[model samples]
Target: MDLILRCLIFSLLHQSLYSKPYNIDGLLENGTGAIESLAKPLQDISTKDYSWAKGNQTCSQLLKDCKEFLDLLPSSSSWMLKPVLALGFLQVGCLTEQEPFFLDLIKDKNARTLFNIMAEQTNNSIHPTTTNSHKSQPDIQKHDLLRFNLESLSIDAQSISHHMHCSEIQQEQQDVLLKGSILRSHSSLQHAMDHCDRVGPVCAGVTSDTLGQFKSVARNGGYIIPHVGSKLWLHHCTAGLLRRRSTDPECHSEKELRIHNVMQWIPVVSGYYNAGSAIYYATQGCTAQAEDRAIDASIDLGYDALFTATGGVSGAVSAGVGMAVKPPLRDGVKSAINYFKAQWSG
Candidate 1:
């Protein structure tokens, strides 16, 4: 028994000493290879006037391949694979029609480094230097000297945001809905600003302005309004107003009324309309200045007045009627809104 134990210990020690350090390099190389393979196809789709069907098919395939590559990666090295995963998702988002899954990725440090690398690569590809033509590069050059910064990352993110078929308003709405806290809404906004700092000023300005508007709405009693359905409905309405205000600060109340009508029926459809409107006015670009002015105007006029002018009375009556018939729903709405108010104020 002693002899057998000694042999087992010796064998285990030898294996431990000789085993490979996690092959991060190999994993990164494979990831880059996957990215490069999809890049050309993505480039073609962007530059060419292809039909939506054709482009969507190509995008779907790329997404599949990306998923396959990710699935094959060793589960133990998932932390190391975040950047690669971020890059793959970004590429797919640039080509696909749906909203991109990039918000969480943008929050990751490793993913940001990968974004910087891609941006640098893109910059070099766009403007190649003539002096480096004579050098013979080694197969495995060290990128330890490569500096990753926010400037390139911001540019890359902005470019991706533009291609993803959603407006800044829609993006901001999604950001709030996903990450915003009904309670601790202030902290949520702060977290968003922290994220924006990593992403750069373009995002910071927009995110700040949008969240500021949300705060303004909360401060002004917009959130506690009875019969508004839910905070989500209120958020959707605010986004529509903000998007319209991004262009015409003095946009007619008729549009606002239409939105209120839609919300009264199918609150979700209003969200879709707002998203579509955002795409339609995507070129207008929701600047911080525009948003600030809009907020000021909305506040000066008062949200209650705006809602009242845009058919709030009828909607309130309808909600009252519904509440009268369904005591549970009425209680639920009261409890929910009260809880929301407590969180908002707290």
Candidate 2:
């Protein structure tokens, strides 16, 4: 009788997973589950918009604000926080890397064409009315401009990182270092390319090439290539963690330290995606490209790491209860299979 009852309950639950009006009441009982639940509403909003919305009251800000809401509740195990935190960190990391790249792409006419297509589609989805249609047009354009602004900022950002080597800085500079005559020569090509490419990979390639050209433009235009030169100088000054004179001539040690401090918070800013956990487990929200990417990547990475680190926490916990348990070797093999499937599907 007990066997039959257990089978029936499991079947009902499994069926409910695919049924309509999926509920979160079950998942919300757990911390990680609850955090995931909360992230659902704003999963589709752009990180740039979310950062801006903290001031502009956009959906992104609404999502970021979930941190405070989570804090208000009772504390939970670090296990729950790991996935949440991981998702957050990954989001910020991707954004940090891609933001500047996107800016460079915008400088190319080929890349701009791609950006315009993506930007317009993203904008139209947000505000769906007559006046909003016109007003939101600029919003899309602004998204493209953000890439440029971020790239310039990235140059300054790198300058302040004292840990980077001169060789690294020079390599980075080469990527963005635009020289005289070259900028003028490439400018038209970039604009033309930005408009020309429509396909994803071709468009992406155009954007990357265009940014390289812009680097030359910025460098030759006498722009201050911040961290590249600054970091190299800092390394020259403070060889070790030795506290040097505050008056060290070659480096802005204090400024670099401050910038690094700010960079540390990028993960926190990105953690808003964890709300997708609730959406996924609860079936409450629609899956989006960004949100789904955030979840699947973390799940794929986190589950494997956790299984290894905890020596299979679930199996260990199940051992005492006499549940049929897969050995670590078998479990690992199964996990590997699932990881590839999830990665490819996502």
Candidate 3:
């Protein structure tokens, strides 16, 4: 071996020289002084960002640590430990192309070292009847390293999922607020329809029935409300068109009747009759049933109100993030659910 390669081998053997089944813990049974000692130099070297000059130094140090650790292991330990070792070397190799001379220490040896071990472990684990627990010899160090790599990947995936979820909720909130504003505007029109007298026919272009059409428009916009605790105002052409009834002042009936403009019913009815243009298109369908429309409108409005409120809370957390973060927090919750489906299958 070259002088550089020899030093690296010595560093690895320093950790395993004391044990046979290549017991990592048994080697450190009294204390973890040896592994720490090996890791410290590498850690110090790693702190410097890898570049052509610094990168070479760090790679050399890391290679020394990895090789010495590998050479000290018994033949049997290498069989089980190779895959994880290979993966670690793969990570190091990735680090190298980015740094080139930076990985000088283990540049040549890293992959070969890991691949050889991985091939050995693959051979040992392939027997159809082999039981994991019943394996001839257990190599804890290799098992531990493999677990570490898997855990690192898992953590990254989970972080992405969380960020995506937060973004979805914020979007849902904005949608709800937008829909609610539309509903409130519609409510004001409904108020006008109830209190204003008719200028012409019941379905006159700008008459009371115009409010009914607004309800239908709201539905097409994705608002859906449940049946619970719904409130709506009903409007209909009643039979008592001309008769005026005397109200007892003590009963305070005038206040209740004030919405109808009892004094000017004749003029109000005439305005609906002669209006030059229609305010809204008449639904050829039985469209005058304002109460029903109100109920449906109210339902849609409620849906929008609730949706935005809840969605807003969700969206603010994840807004402006990637689409990955937005959907689950709002209407895209179904998509988020699909992600879980894949996870569950795995």
Candidate 4:
């Protein structure tokens, strides 16, 4: 990797390594939205921003499935969806180029190193068949890393299904072990799972737990969230996305190819909207700063959407970022204000 890409990867990984997962299921308003119809599609495909919470689920059914989705996801398929979005989000290149992208990453061993770090985080105990956590293995390839993460995710998901709640102490031990695993040394975690602890206090006396805590639990249990290195992937893919098809420029139409390639990113955009809105709801009643942060989250998410739709770094940046971010940012601010006001009055 060149210095720019290396620095970008390290910066993103370090900044985002310990960030929280956003639980979209918890963002509903009294079971509103058509969640069931949406849920079926989201199972195989990622979602879009405008339709983030626009589910056809009635309040009653939304209450049922949203709760269930949050309670315990037995399948790792849901957990793996977010990473799929990440891959899609970073697809500045054609889909066919993905093999070489992974290949190039393997050449430098970064792919192996990154996955090994996740493998270190891999833990199991839910299903008898899924005990393997991908740890302590030798001579792993880049492709194996994500597959191992998926397996590990399956184990964690099954544990949730079985009600194997990992106490903070045990989670802490895992964190310490992961810390000492010699991955990246220089450090300060700006946000930890613990940092959001106070988010639960917002519901003191009225609710059993803070919205943030519940959402975080749902996130951890279900495994639906983004992680580091997507931006680098985005950067890498940008060239292919902007350039005409080299495979068979004459035979295969560029428009069709581009459409196929960009579709991968659309669902990820929905993922961002869903997750960001969840956080907005989670932190809305906490504080003004928290509320402001939620708005910021949506704006950040908008950038991801712009990347896929617009194509190329310059195109994404030059186009109206304000226009891109405005809708969600506005909605977030409105919701935050409305939520805290209702809480105080109640």
- Which wins on TM-score, candidate 3 or candidate 4? 4
Query: What Cα-based lDDT does every candidate model obtain?
Result: 0.27, 0.26, 0.23, 0.25
TM-score, per-candidate, Cα-based: 0.20, 0.17, 0.15, 0.19
Better of 1 and 4 by lDDT: 1
Name the runs in model 1 displaced over 4 angstroms.
1-57, 75-85, 88-100, 104-107, 120-126, 131-346
| Tens digits of lDDT, candidate 4, 1-346 | 4446544643453233221222222223323332331232111221223221222323344323333432332221222222322233233222222454333322322223222222222211121122333322111111111111221232222332233222221111110001001111111222323332323211111001111211122222121112122101000000112111124333232332232223212322333323222222221221222223223333333322222211211111121221122122333334544554464345
lDDT (Cα) of model 4: 0.25
Q: Give me the runs in candidate 4 sitting further than 4 Å from their true place.
A: 1-81, 84-90, 94-203, 207-293, 297-346
Candidate ranking (TM-score, best to worst): 1, 4, 2, 3
Quick one: best TM-score, which candidate? 1
Order of all candidates by lDDT, from best down to worst?
1, 2, 4, 3
Worst 10 residues of 3 by lDDT: 273-282
Taking all chains together, the TM-score of candidate 2 against the true structure is 0.17
Model 3 root mean square deviation, Cα atoms? 34.4
Measured with C-alpha atoms, the lDDT of residue 251 in candidate 2 is 27
Q: What lDDT score goes with residue 109 in model 1? A: 43
Q: Which model, 2 or 4, shows the larger TM-score?
A: 4
Candidate 3 lDDT tens digits, 138-188: 112111111111211221222322222111001011111112112222344
Candidate 3 structure lDDT: 0.23
